[model samples]
Target: MALFGFIGAGNMGLPLMKAAAATFGKNEVIFTDASKERSQFVSDQTGIRFLTDNCSVVKQCKNLVLAVKPQFFPVVLNEIKDVVTKDQIVISIAAGIKIESIKSMLSNSVRIVRAMPNTPAMVLQGMSGICFSEDTFTDEEKEIIDRFFKSFGKYEVFDERLMNAVVCANGSSPAYVYMFIEALADSVVSYGIPRDKAYELAAQTVLGSAALVLETGEHPGKLKDQVCSPGGTTIAAVKALEEYGFRNAIMKATDACYKKCEELSNK
Candidate 1:
């Protein structure tokens, strides 16, 4: 039996399936997409097996991953609900889809985990927020869950109540960061720097700054203070950022993101 059987092989599903294959082995992972062509493309790319449909995946795998978009969860869960066994755990990466709702859609006995992972998982540097339906896990189950997320990158288990916050903070935050990078690059390019060079410089600075924060364990504000000196260019930029409400913009953007996530959940 396959260790993981993915029901969708779209953008998020594809990278996550790749990560699972890397963690276990290609032979132990099976997936099926609504598009036969997409399944074939992934099969040709990874040499992993592909089943013909979602229910078939349920029968053949020890763990089932509901990787389809949130809007399609009702149909997909209905299709596999009868076949999903209590022995098989269901791990969902669908945004804003609550674990309780999934259990109601399928079976309450179904073991479920809700995870929010961003596009960064494509590069295996993703951060995932995991929430289990139950309060605790068995030793073996814990190992399986850890390997499942850590295959792509780091993971932190959180209360299911915070899953939407997880979506706002990290799962959707990458797009925000990309916009920031693009704006920085555009500003530099307007200053006569080659567009390509400007992007390279801006992206590297962002990458380095994140690495420094992770490595040093210093408060971000402290690090910002370190960069800003009296009568310096960095301080001037900081002042301009404050005057323009840069921090408020990001917080408000995230507020919108969180609202959307809540909206999806309430649907």
Candidate 2:
């Protein structure tokens, strides 16, 4: 029997499955998807088993991951609800789906974990936020969950109520960071730098700056101050960004993302 069963084989699901295969034997990891071609492709590429039926996956695996889209959760849960045993733990990556909602769809006593993992998992640099249902896990079970998440990158356990904030802070913020990098690159290119070289420089600067923040454990504001010497060119560039409401724009974007998550959860 497979130890882990994933219900989708899309972008996020495929990366997660590949990561799991590193620790678990490829034969121990199985998955199913609506598209047979996609599932077959992943199975052939990774040497993991692919089942045709979702319920078959539930019957075979004790650890299940609901990697389907949020809108499909109801149908997927309904199909597997009858076969899901108390021994099985369901980990959900569907955005905006709450533990309580999942419990209501399945059995109240079912062990459920809701996780928010971003697209960075594709590159093994993901940040995941995890939360558990009222049904508690044993030490071994918790360890299994941690190992599965850490296969790709780091994770943190938090109250489910803060999941939306996590979504804004890490899950959705990567897009904003990408936009910043593109803008920076464009500005340099306008100054006669080659387009490709500008992009490389801007992207490397972002990567190195983020590394400095993590290594130094210093406040970002203080780090920014360090770069802005007395009447320096860096300070002038910073002033231009401030004049264009850069910080406020980011704050508003995150606020909007959080509100949209709330709206989706309510629906």
> Each model's TM-score, in the order given?
0.97, 0.96
**lDDT (Cα, tens digit) per residue for candidate 1, span 1-267:** 988999998889989999999889998899999999999999999888999999899999988888899999999999898999888889999988898899998888889989998888999989999888984558897898899899998999899999999998899899988999999999988989999999899889998999999999999999999999999999999999999999999899889988998998998
- 1-267, model 2: which lDDT tens digit per residue? 788999998988999999998877787799999999998898889988899999999999979999998889899989988999888999998778888988888998899999999888998989899999888689999888999999998999999999988889888898998999899999888989999999899988998999999999999999999999999999999999999999999999998999988987997
The residue pairs that clash in candidate 1, if any, are none
| Number of the top TM-score candidate | 1
- Candidates' C-alpha lDDT: 0.91, 0.91
| Lowest lDDT 10-residue stretch of candidate 2 | 21-30
The superposed Cα distance between candidate 1 and the true structure at residue 171, in angstroms, equals: 0.5
The local lDDT score (0 to 100) that residue 116 gets in candidate 2 is 90
Candidate 2, residue 239: lDDT: 98
